[model samples]
Target: MKNVLLVLFLSISMIIIYVFIPQQQSIVFQPNDSNANMAYIPTKEETQFKIKYTHSIHLTDVVESYKITPSKKIHQYELMYEDFSIGMPSNAEEGETFEVLNGSYYIKNMKRIFPFFHLRIGQVRANHTVIFKNVEYPLSHSIPPGTSVKVEIRTLNFIDLWKGVNILESL
Candidate 1:
């Protein structure tokens, strides 16, 4: 009887594990010390993106409190910047571009999101473009000094949605 029970438990455990686990791909960024930040905190109703600051900079008159509004399929939360990062890749200027493939972004030291692919940037500035998989986004923002800008990363996967927290200083 004990043998039969043990076999049954093992079978059940195997079935559960097979049905629940997702295949996750992990990649580490080079230089291995790029700074990233979450500019804002998400509210209960907000379910799309989270923001943070990669560096500690000053911002002015930025929106302190906000809520998620209506959307069609994807809701975009805009984090108006006061003072944004002036970070650029080696030799990159206010109008140059770069790319980081197989890149990994860690939020608040907990959740990790890896894109299927990446694209090169078209320009560089305090506010530049970040193109990934044909989707163009901003690299930096324009905000007031002493104020921080918020970044809005998608919250699609259910597991990654609830792990919102402030972005750390470095990735």
Candidate 2:
């Protein structure tokens, strides 16, 4: 009975040390001089292109769905289900920023490792619908030329939750 109890106790102790102790002692990303983790920010030079398109307007529907709210410091627009806050914060607008790599269309010419930048904008925080430090420009105007308008753009990401699974959904 004594020998059996000693063996059982040793087995349980080994399992507990193997699973919990090492995980708690491991150090994750080492911090840089700026005190931010190097893993989070883009360390390489990234190329981004600015593209704009004008959506022509008809008199009937041009100004039908527009609501603009101007504040003392900045402007905000409320259209349909979204309320867009325009302009970046004063400090950020002066140019301190960070970004991430996103591929709009996978480029075939370059090596598979490097994806061409179709469009590059500021990185969005987790659980956010809009990109940071970006102006929300509304394409809902029929003005002759240079009429200031507010537009709201939303980016969507579809994640394949079952990548390593054996079966896929039947459609």
Q: What do the candidate models score in CA lDDT, each in turn?
A: 0.29, 0.21
Write model 2 residue lDDT over 117-170, tens digit each, in one string.
121211221111121123222211111122221222211111111111111111
Q: How close is candidate 2 to the true structure, as a TM-score?
A: 0.18
Candidate 2 least-lDDT 10 residues: 162-171
lDDT of 1 by residue, 1-171 (tens): 999999999999987665555322111111112233222222334333322233323322221111233321222223333333453213323332332323421111112222312222123222323222233333333222232323332332223322322222211
Q: Return the TM-score for each candidate structure.
A: 0.23, 0.18
Off by over 4 Å in 1: 1-20, 23-46, 54-76, 83-171
